[model samples]
Target: MAEALIKKHSRTKLDMTQGPIMKLVILFALPIIASNVLQQFYTIMDTLIIGNFCGATSIAAIGTSSQPVEVFMCVFMGIGGGVSILVSMHTGSKDDESLRKTVKTSVSFTYITAIPLAVLGIILTPVILRFMNVPDDTWDLAVLYIRIVFVGLLGNMGYNMNAGVLRGLGDSSSTLLFLIISSVTNIVLDLLFVAGFGMDVAGAAIATIIAMYLSWFSSVIYIIRKYPHIEFSFLPKGIDRESLKNILKLGLPLGFNNSLYTVGHILLQTLINLQGSAFMAGASVAGKIMGVSSVAISSFSQAMSTFAGQNFGARDYGRLKKGGRIVPLYSALITMSLGIVMYIFAPQLVGFFTKDGMAIKYALLCVHIQIPFQWCFCVLNTILNLANGIGAVRYSTVVNLLMLWAVRIPSAYLIATFWDGHYVTGGVSISFVFGMLAALLFYRSSHWARICRA
Candidate 1:
């Protein structure tokens, strides 16, 4: 009966194989765009609460506190990426059992790892902030916020993996629903905890943690109930060593690549810290604002990965190429337009974080300089996602990692050291240029296409 259910809803039977590339790409990409953007909205709400009610010090504290968490979150997301590609391949092959096993194992692994990490994070909050050179003024708030969020790492990991699994199954709508709920919950809690209770940045962080857990639990329950294809025995049963090994192999590089990429940002954050608390606070707000652009383009990136993985599994190179071209062109246009809108409204937008004139001016500068380069990254990411989908792991891993350390880090160091009056702004803009160029070079290479066909 279960087998019959699987057959009835098999991917091939859905007839996704023969669509116009643009339509198919849009179909796959839009829900992801909605979900990803909404996630940024949740973070924005957290910032807004802290910035408005708790003050700029709180905003800076929360923002600075979030970097390591973001690093860990990226790794968790990378693990989900490994699971997603596996599921996408199995999905295209009409192997429902493999999907179920992958889902179970990945979920189990996430839970096991996240809980311990969260505990460690809670214990290490002060130590981390001290290393980051968080100012004495912001240290208390930063430690409070980071510790709260650290304790909730399981929820964060669960949400990421849940959404990744849904994406793998070509079901982005469910993920969107969860993000909507979480964003709404986050905003309401932000207001209640920070504004009403006067709990400050810690309150905002706590609110975010509550919403995250709620979203994760809701997604897990819904998937178990609605997606019978994914529900299965939780216990380890005749574990597939090959599948497990593949996931580890893919996940570790993907996770390490993500971490290494963030390492450059981590270093940049250190540099920004040197400029004083006001600059650090302004940079934090600007970076959060930039996360808005990624919402749309990153959605396309996720879709490209899933589409490529599925088509690759079916050995459908035509569909893969079609996807590669369509997603980049579409996402680039959408994100570029949004970036322009954000740039135009930069003064009004930055004011939400602080009333300080200098902070607002620097924030606008960051916006103007970063947006065009961000547009270029839309193209870069699509190609990279496609590479991941087709199991071109080494190439994608190498491209992103090298760009961060070799091009981005070195360029930032040189610019900041030699360029008089250039500041963090110059260092960041130059780094973006180098990273974007590296991505384009990799995308243009024949090797990526060959890997897709492999």
Candidate 2:
């Protein structure tokens, strides 16, 4: 009976080991794409409400908090990525026992790691804000917002882990469904707390945390009721040494890479903060816009990761090779199209966040400079994720470290310090281009391919 249930659920999963490659990739990616867009939309709405109701300082507060939050959450996201890949591989090979073990171990690991991380994040909120050099006008608000949000990190991590498991099982739609519910709830709460109640940044943070908990709750229920074959347990007996080792071996490099990447952003954010409130606010809005514009590429990269993980696990090199070539082309076309739209409307989009002319101008400039290079990002992300999916995580980590530390961060600092006044932000944009190109060159050299094949 359990085997029958497993087989029934299998019908919903995309068998990446065989299929019409383009169609399968698109079908797999579209829901993920919608989920990404909706997630970004609610996030944008959060900023929008804060900017409109709470003012520019509030906008800066939320924006500045993002880097530190990402830095702290990097390990959790890395583990989620690792879990997704492992589960996908097991699903591909139909290894039920290993799949159940991986799920249980991932759940245990997430809880163990998230609790301390949350406490640390709350305790260090002020220090992180100071390190980022948050403007005095915005520092208090940033601290308040970050502290409240940090309290909910466990819920956020829980949802991410469960969603990853679903995605690994080729059940992307379920994740999307839960995200839609969460996004709607977030927007409603944002309006009520920030606009109706006049709560400011704290309200926004509370809304976000509440929404995160809702998603986490829904995911836990779904997994319990639907995925009976996959054990969902947090008890000591559920822990397995081999499973833990496998997850860490695959996850830690990606975690470190994410931490390295966030460190670079923190450095860049500090530099941007030095440019004053207008520039800081502008950069924050620009970051949100860029996230929206790049959702397609990001979604497709995630899809590619799952696809590659499954095919590699099954040792189906031919399909993996075909996907390698076709996926990038599709991603480039979609990203290019979206990038052009965003560039054309850059001013209007930035205006949605702030009416301050200087803020809008800086934000528009950022969009103009970055959107043209969207294809480079698409290529870079897709290739790296593919490397991750194939368990060649170490190479991806090295590539990310070199690109972020060696290229992006230093270039941003040099431009800010030595370059002419008007060119600093543009120079930062150019660094992204260089970093992507470096990654693309390495990918083209087939280094990741060799690693995966071996």
Candidate 3:
């Protein structure tokens, strides 16, 4: 019965070792992508509300301040990633007891870590905003928005941790259900608070925080009630320090590197801000459009990781190779299609976020620059996901760090200084192109597969 349950619940939910690899992958990724895209709808609404009702500066300020908070959130994601790697491995190895402990400890660490980060965010909001060189006009609204999001850090971390564990168990569909419900709730609240009540950015922040907790709560309950195999009480008596250490050891560098990558983007954001409100507004709208496109890519990448991790854990090298080949190909094809759509409809997409004609025009320019690289991102992300799932999180981190310093940052700096073009657009677009190329090359290297063997 335990074995049956194991077979039933493993990530991708179905055993990928059987049947056509593409069919399994698409079936697994579709719902996860839908969940991810639905979750982004609230962000879309937030931008719409802030830009239309509260105006351009509000959108600019909030978007600017968002960078650092995102860094903190990415760290939580890293912790969750570590937990996921361990759970995936244990599930693959059929170690039920160890899986439970990993889940419990992961949740504990997430809660503990997130609280301090939240408190720090509250205290440091103004200082950090200043560091980003936020203009006097937008600082107050920016600070308010960032502070509220900070207050909800625990919820963000909790939800991500629980959902990560679930996905590790091969239950992507369940996580999707929670996200869909929460996303709907978020959209409703966003309309009520931001558009209906005119609560502005504060209202948008409240809607987001509330939705995160709801999703987290629902997932926790489901995990406890439906997935007793990974419940807290099922934790083994003999804690495996080595096992836990291995997870964290591989994951921490990735976490830190991801955090640093966010900082680099923040640096770029600072440059964006210095260009004034029009540039910021344009960038914000462009970012939202990009966010919409990127969601599908991210969903597929995440599913790929879970699928690859399970096969890796089982020592099913044949299935792993099938996954390694199929995922990038599928993701690239999908992204190229989306990229074409984005290129054609760039104006319409950016228009949804704001009415400012100049904002729309500049945003279109950024979108054009970005569309060509969307497929490249698909390839890079596919590689990263595969690396992560196969226990090469450290290598993934190293590649990311290298991409940032060697490819992205230098390209951005040179473009900004030499071209007399707007730093914000040049910085973002140039780095994106270089980073994608470099990432694809690194992904093709043998080191990642070697780590999987180790």
Candidate 4:
């Protein structure tokens, strides 16, 4: 029955298993890279508009709000990652029956997980903020932003699930349209709510929430028009047994890792909070600047994973081996090029976020410590994506855990306690070196090498 439905399949624009590795990877990565830029641009606009209109305290509020939101969002991101991996493999093998089931189960999983998490997030927002040691100045704004955003969490998770299906089946460009529309919607609403009506951080949150639903709805309409086999629904058909098993097999570890990973970050955020609101606002600004600079690392990671997943599924070991080596190096070079540009223009870029002198000072301090070594992240990220593409995730999960628990958290605390707290950004940079070294071992002893040989 499921196989019969797949007879209406629409072939992906680029088949991963058949192409020049470099050309195909770049073609596929370009849209994803562009989408990342749009993400950063809107993010910057959020801070720029808020900092200008609402003051530095609001920017600090947003910075505080983000990690709590990420804690809720990352678990579903892992589910999306797992869905894409399975879809790529199933597509590569031309297993239509399993592919259909995976798509169905993905919708069910999203519906099941998202609402409960969202409710939990909203209810716990104040307590969570307090636990993070959010000072009185930024506390109320953080509570308001987080709760409003949580209202749209279901739409955001559903959109990701839909996008994951397309990406897994080798369609990367379509989501770019979704992002553009969302970006436009967000900016326009920001002008109306924040600028015109003076809604402050509340306005920014509302604007982003509306865009989230629009991205999900637009993705649904596109899927229905182009690939009718995919019908994205908030109310799913009863969970398919085989698909549930497959999803859990990959999804659970990845989901737990993502959730825990964000929790680890929340601890780091606590360290940042202790530095005061001016430093918090500055670090937030630096993140936006460096986010754009480091986009290539993440963009290529997604592209490489899809490419590797499809090839691995098709038993095209040659491309897998080749891409694993080539893509990471390309990503590193691109990252460094952007990092150099950001490093040169740091003051101007940081200034673009706000006029506050103290915030600019601390933002530059954070950027100087972090941006120079972003190339290391590129290498580590692409390597793990290679492993993810091939459905060999345990080692990568372990690597991430070790980097956070063993390296980042301890180092961050020690640097703040013993050394100049201004230099604490060095903690993440130090972990990058550690993570890169650990990721390299995936190629050395992992079953991916054995799978390639077999």
Best by lDDT: 4
Give candidate 4 regions above 4 Å deviation. Answer: 1-12, 230-234
Between candidates 3 and 4, which one is better according to lDDT? 4
Per-candidate Cα lDDT values, in order, are: 0.75, 0.84, 0.76, 0.88
| lDDT, candidate 4, 249-281, per-residue tens | 887778877987898889989999999999999
TM-score of 1: 0.92
lDDT winner between candidates 1 and 4: 4
- Candidate 2 steric clashes: 0
Best by TM-score: 4
* All-Cα superposition RMSD per candidate: 2.5, 1.8, 2.7, 1.8
Error of 1 at 278 (Å): 1.1
Off by over 4 Å in 2: 234-237, 420-423, 441-454
Candidate 2: what lDDT?
Answer: 0.84
Summed backbone clashes in each candidate are 0, 0, 3, 0
Estimate TM-scores for all models: 0.92, 0.96, 0.92, 0.97
Q: Where does model 1 exceed 4 Å of error?
A: 7-16, 232-239, 420-422, 443-454
Please give the lDDT score for candidate 3: 0.76
Q: What is the lDDT of residue 287 in candidate 4?
A: 93
Pick the winner on TM-score between candidates 2 and 3: 2
* Candidate 3 segments whose C-alpha is farther than 4 A from its true place: 1-12, 233-240, 421-423, 441-454
